[model samples]
Target: MERLVNQDASERNAVEGKFGEGKRKYGLDLIRARLQETSETVIALQFLIMNLGRKLRVLFFKFLQNTILSFDN
Candidate 1:
């Protein structure tokens, strides 16, 4: 099912593509731009995940300390 949909989409795009010498160049330019944007987004997400993981670890340790201290009281 997914393959059928993808094939149909490609066929439609092929028909609409500009039939000129610059068409291939334009497509490659768009592809390059999209790849750069995707890479930057992935890097940003990894940074955010690392920060969140650190925060969660600190919180968990604090929680354990509080529980143990309260028990001593």
Candidate 2:
């Protein structure tokens, strides 16, 4: 269906965007590991770091919001 196609495209875009971000911001683009296992590990670590960064940002924004609200009370 057309709806399903649109949903798939949206999901693909989000995934691709994250990969692009990883390569650009992290050292994903510079990975020089020749072994398959080592390359996989490097990729996994990069994604893990990316996830941790995203989580920290979310937590920071929540803390900022709480601080601002407390001042308004």
Candidate 3:
């Protein structure tokens, strides 16, 4: 029972953290769409952008690592 409670809290925190990040970093907090569909679309696009940014960062690091290695050899 205690383990289950902890797991639930952890999951909730992760979700809340993402919302906070989206609001702070992605302008999610400023959304003022009048329709439900529009609001959902905007939110979805924000998350998509966030995902793309993460992927780009990973690729950038890999590129940097390869560049450094090539210089060493």
Candidate 4:
């Protein structure tokens, strides 16, 4: 169905966007590992770093929000 196709495309776009971000921002586009294992490790580590960065950002903002709220009490 057309709806299913649209959904698939949307999902694909989201995934591709993440890949682009990883490559552009995290140096994933410059991977030069020749071995399969090394390549996989590099990819995994890149994603792990990206995920950790996002988590830290979220935690930091939440802490900032709470601190500001406490000041108003």
Q: lDDT per prediction?
A: 0.64, 0.96, 0.98, 0.97
Candidate 3 runs further than 4 Å off: none
Error of 3 at 50 (Å): 0.5
> What are the per-model numbers of colliding residue pairs?
0, 0, 0, 0
lDDT of candidate 4 over 1-73, digit per residue (tens): 9999999999999999999999899999899999999999999999999999999999999999999999999
For candidate 1, the per-residue lDDT at 64 reads 100
Model 3, residue 26: C-alpha shift (Å): 0.6
Output the worst ten-in-a-row residue range by lDDT, candidate 1. 20-29
What lDDT does model 1 reach?
0.64
In candidate 2, position 15 carries an lDDT of 95
Ranking by lDDT: 3, 4, 2, 1
lDDT of 1 at 2: 100
Which residue pairs clash in candidate 3? none
What tens-digit string does per-residue lDDT give for candidate 3 at 1-73?
A: 9999999999999999999999999999999999999999999999999999999999999999999999999
**1-73, model 1: which lDDT tens digit per residue?**
9999999999888655633322353222333334778856664554566557779999999999999999999
Q: Indicate the TM-score of model 2.
A: 0.85
> Model 1 TM-score?
0.53
User: What is the alpha-carbon lDDT of model 3 when measured against the actual structure?
Assistant: 0.98
